[model samples]
Target: MSVSNSPNSIPCLLLAAGRGERMRPLTDELPKPLLTIKNKSLLAWHLEALSAADVENVVINHAWLGNKIEEALGNGSQFDLNITYSPEISALETAGGIRKALPLLNPSDYFLVINGDVFSPNLPLQGLLDQVSALRSMPNQPLAHLLMVPNPNQHPEGDFYLKDSKVTNEPLDGAEKLTFSGIGLYHQELFKDLELNVPSKLAPLLRVAMAKNRVSGEKYAGPWHDVGTPQRLQELNAAHE
Candidate 1:
């Protein structure tokens, strides 16, 4: 669990386990993270971003077509990062997959996690790193800190509300309902009790933490794409082309 490249480095886990059912025929042959955009794999883009962020270690969890991910990324040397894979026989959703890979992560009390499907090139890791340091020093630490954004057309209702930098389930008077960017920093304790290899969703855990006022977040107005459908993927490629 000591994934640090140094005593202070924060390790990151990239989630790549979803079946991408909406992506169907394309995902039939390749995992969603392996789908290309502007000639680069989705996972590759994150790897490069992480490397640029100075995050030296990464643990990627994959299920469908997992081997091909290993084939394409190998040991992560190309990206100047230490890449480790956590293979799942079946997609274990979000929380379960994190529980399964906890042992492979840096047990620095808190660690970074990013969803592999979303494209948010500007999602700042340094800010998350600074948060990790500040939170660690607090006598009462929050379970997670999320990056939120205005509801995208695909998810108009949004997921949670963010008020004064706090994430909440209800639309509190001053809270702004927003969508989770799938980028966060979580304390290891959040997944400590979760059963490994079992399918579990992240929303329930986050909601529970929100009820306890243990979740915090920020709104990000930047380029982001979920790429859930084939059309979105095509649009991204076409725009770049």
Candidate 2:
């Protein structure tokens, strides 16, 4: 799908509320997003990526060492991005965290969401926008569009299947499994009828949309890493550096 060349002012929500259980000691002193990679914090790198894509506003949710993260990157003016924090007493899972940050997101427009701990090659933001547009064009469209990637070494079976640009929770027969790339474009409609203050998992909500052929996706054949473990982070840092 072709996307418009003009840069869009899409806002981004970065999920930084994890406890980093696998990155214990390192995270004991600092949040995983604050870990130095080539003298730059992972959070900083993500901000730079967003800025390069012309994304201006960013909502970051935090819990572990949350205050320190806010102190380190105040208002995000330094990165040419406006930053807002959603402080949570208890770390909410992806869906819950996003719901908590909804107040900071675009009130009536589609926005971007990504896992804060993972790293990926320069994202095709335009392609994501195209998917959102396509979904909105259809009658009674879905609320989200995901960016998927071919199965990585760690997750060979993958998390979900993609066929004909639609997502499915059901395992496909002899289908090439693909993993979610931790990056997505989402419309506010996904949470339209959701009650506030209730914890939710994004997967089930997405699956519902997929069942109706509302959720859309595109396979991204690019460098992607889900740095969920210390060993994996070390390997990625070494290889990328």
Question: Who wins the lDDT comparison?
Answer: 1
Write candidate 2's Cα lDDT for 192-225 as tens digits.
7666656677888888887777777779997777
Candidate 2 TM-score versus the reference: 0.90
| CA shift of 176, model 1, Å | 0.4
Report the poorest 10 consecutive residues by lDDT, candidate 2: 1-10
lDDT of 1: 0.88
| Candidate 1 C-alpha lDDT tens digits along 1-241 | 1234444468899999889999989999899999989999889889988887788879999999999999999889999899999999999999999999998985768888999999876667776677776777766688999989889999999999999888999889978999998999899998877877899999999999999999988888988888899999999999989
RMSD of 2: 3.5
Model 1 ranges with Cα > 4 A deviation: 1-8
Question: C-alpha displacement of 110 in model 1, angstroms?
Answer: 0.8
Residue 54, candidate 2: Cα error in Å is 1.2
Q: How close is every model to the real structure, measured as TM-score?
A: 0.95, 0.90
Candidate 2 backbone collisions, by pair = none
